[model samples]
Target: MPIDHLNPPTGAMADNVIGFARALRKAGLPIGPGAAIDALAALQLIEIGKRADVYATLEAIFVKRHEHALIFHQAFDLFFRAEEDWKQMLDSVPLPDDARRKPPPASRRVQEAMAQPLKGEEREAPQEQEIKLSVSDREVLQKKDFAQMSAAEIAEVTRAIATMRLPQAELRTRRTRPDRQGVRLDLRRTLRASLRTGGDIVDIRRLGLIDKPAPIVALLDISGSMSEYTRLFLHFLHAITDARKRVSVFLFGTRLTNVTRALRARDPDEALASCTASVEDWAGGTRISASLHNFNKLWGRRVLGQGAIVLLISDGLEREADSQLAFEMDRLHRSCRKLIWLNPLLRFDGFEPKAQGIKMMLPHVDEFRPVHNLTSIDGLIKALSAPTSGHHGPLIRPAA
Candidate 1:
């Protein structure tokens, strides 16, 4: 196949490399001008007899950003090397040829997804329609599991999460001290300010608005074990940001790092790529208590306003099962509206809060949910809507 017919390895458009880079960016490859020029130069250097060889060369630059690697590989395979196949089968609109088309491997957990609809048909919210979920199995029998998934699959899941929103976040008043923006005037503060007016001999007015910014703070774990799930959750937080403005996202591994601003990008892939660029502790160890203590000290005041719902996302596996874990949990619980703990380990059929870490964190959380697969995520959406439902701890494990 001649190069022109096969998109000419992106020819004269080489000067229009920025456009190509943008296309790659949309296609979920972490592309930039520098890389595009490199891609063009590499093509000139390498023998392009085989399409695969050329593709491998390009993949090197685009996939440098770890998360985008899978995406670049998938889009590269599908877009280039069109062959006569997709054209030949255009009438049929069939799948690509075998060399290009591979079936879902035998280990596909189709049964796991089958056990539940992930999200039931009842909640008919338009923006939240993409909230489809996959299950998290406690005993992951499959290796190279999340690692083996194509970028397209993960992208679909990521997009679904990006648009998801909570329909029922009804606000309730916990206590009122009276301030500027709220319904009542602060008797104390108003009186203090009025004292300036000579004990309010004239028109009396109040100052200072005391309304809180709705309540919810998320402290997520992006350690090696929780990496795949955490990546998805970041997308979920992005969706939540749209649904609820000013939502904070803190990622933890051996230590704590904040990526709230990065995930706020208007574009999902761009947002995820920016997030990937900001974090160095991508696949490292977990330190729950340490992370919470750091969060409780550093971020507790800024984002944890209005009795915020503290979401602790991590598997309760402390490298050192110290008592500070409980102390931090106690502090975290006391400081928020509700402390909700999400553990992917809870996806196990026979899961029990067995680990010292899990046991320590369990009692701290007002609610505990799994975060392993898509179904678990969908359930999380449901849980968000009607948190009072009696179906709280119903463990529906995925069968092989």
Candidate 2:
């Protein structure tokens, strides 16, 4: 493709594409000035009047990831249109009852983006008004359930989550390093120091066990029951992965899928897009036993070493009562130094181990905590940071 079309005429079509690009950027696609220019050039190669050709041209130029496709489509429909079509849309025409149908409303982000003033235009400021506030907006959001949050709120939470960092909780290894005040004596190092002193004096060298941050292995459930929570948790995991190189991530629904490399991308949006593309069983039925079995047999030995911490994020609602679920859970617990079960269902005050999977797996987890809101996630961070003895002992639930 000869991109010589860059010198296209600055016609009304050019203006429309520029305005459309602005709307897309506001709606969260990474549209820059160069992208807008490229879009214009690509449009010059296609039939301007044909909507399909125009859409394809602009989409190819602007849409970098799969998740942005919906936002792009919505913005394109609302931004690009003929005056007559807009007039017809504004002034509704009467139609037979059966023929009349309501169109799906645009997403809040797209609506707000399109409502913004175009280039060289001024936006009217809101009138000042006195209002009394109790709690701040963020305070309320911290406790709000992920499933109940609005798109705008979710965006804010995602940004907040990006800033959150995991504490560098280190574990001592068998390997030792020379230390000035270490308890254990290093005879070899001490003898070497004596030789350097020509046996006149001996400088005793002490050794201490090497300490490094524990690796994190997250197995997230992407089943229908966990779709909302897992999506938000993935953003949190992305932050963890960015800060720590030893983090490994896996997504499980009907099967186990390793997404560690995909999440290693620096950009959170791009990382999530790659994850969505790699998984074919998103929002499907949960097969906890089978998924856990596969994970233990394949990835357990690889990622569970070096005193790694395992995060099991799921509702624990298995589709089938597989007898292997308990065995797999135990195997996983044994492989990892700490196994933390993060269940969104724990947000409920009356939550109990009623589900077969929950009951079977609960006993193996070192900690069972809620993962439904930001506060809960903060609690998880604290729990991981605080030092505790190995194997807190199996949990015995009250009989139903």
Candidate 3:
């Protein structure tokens, strides 16, 4: 039956629909009230052949928050798609499969060569070969470490991260309204009562907008130890930035440089190239305490005004891991919403936070996680979607 034509609908129809939309939002689609209305309107356009049609509308309306896109994508497949029992059936399909000609291997098209046969059995000319631009196989290889990677693999990982979008990096905030159950004021209603207090003279008004912005700041280390990973981290920072306007990004090693401007460049290659030129201390010694002291004192007030989540990306093998490092690390921990330290060292199968530098930094971080591979980046998305658990990592540093 058509939903609109199904008689006087149940009194709770709107409530149930709202609840389902909220679940989709929690799963990662950026659905708000307007989109919910759009979803309901879509139901009218589609035939109510089954629940799948209803679900398809909801999924179509809410699947754009890139990070949660994958989850919603998976949920739509698993939830909306009809489940089927399977029995193994084997059959060999015939030669019609070869009807699809083989793609010319690396632009070595036999047809093109035939079209321009060799002159006097000598090669006519080395024609411009087309670069087949696709990323499936290359993306698979980046799940391994760079130190263990071949040169070609390294180049491929760079290109992939330059293009990957980080989903669920958007912040969530709470808002207050008078009709909300947890609202703090009844002033308008109370003022009506206060008219009786002053001989029926209404003498009061109370209303306010309550909001909490997700305070977030990042301190990325660009030390010699972090050279490889830091370059990749910049890509993540850039993706986060294009999604949100006010994110803060800083690069540190021997000194602190606010490369927010450098990162904002539209081209990832240009952005990283500009950042490299702007930084004087690239692949230099780590002076963690000094760089952070500058951040805590100079830029903290401007960026950390809101309860910002601080992301510290580094290997934590500080050149100077002294009382000063402890002091600065402690100061930084106290000034942010959540302090997450993403150590590439954590990628090792057998790792521990046992190094003196890591031991010092670890106790202060609210969470510790790896940030080296595509799988690790995906995990970061999930962690950002909800919250992190079992946050621990090994002490292994990247092999030189």
- Judging by TM-score against the true structure, name the best candidate: 2
Ranking by lDDT: 2, 3, 1
Q: How far in Å is the alpha carbon of 169 misplaced in model 2? A: 4.2
Q: Residue by residue across 1-400, what tens digits does model 3's lDDT show? A: 5544433223234444454555455433467888766666666676544454555566567765434433443443332222221001112222122222332211211222223322334332322221222344545574787556665465556656656554433343344455444435666666676767874645444444454335457788888878888887777777767766677888898899998888887645456777888899999988888999999999988997655778899988986778888888888877776787888887877787677787788777777788887666666656555432222223223321
lDDT for 24 (candidate 2): 83
Misplaced by over 4 Å in model 1 are 1-150, 174-213, 387-400
At residue 197, candidate 1 shows an lDDT of 80
What candidate 3 gets wrong by more than 4 Å, as runs, is: 1-139, 150-213, 387-400
Instruction: State the local distance difference test value for candidate 1.
Output: 0.61
lDDT of 2 by residue, 1-400 (tens): 6766468548555666677788788677898999988877776677655656666777789989866766776676666443233333233333333212322322556776786655443533211110111135767888899999987678778878988887664667778888987889998888878887887556789998776778889999999889899988889999987768899999999988999998887657667878878999999888889999999999888998878889999989986766688899989999888888888887887877888878888878887888999999898888777663454534423211
Better of 2 and 3 by lDDT: 2
Clash counts for all predictions:
8, 0, 9
RMSD of each: 13.2, 8.2, 18.7
TM-score, model 2 to reference: 0.70
The digit string of per-residue lDDT tens for model 1 on 158-256 reads 555665777634344455544445655456665777677888734344444333334557788888888888777877877777767757888888888
> What is the full ranking by TM-score, best candidate first?
2, 3, 1
Tell me, by lDDT, which candidate is best.
2
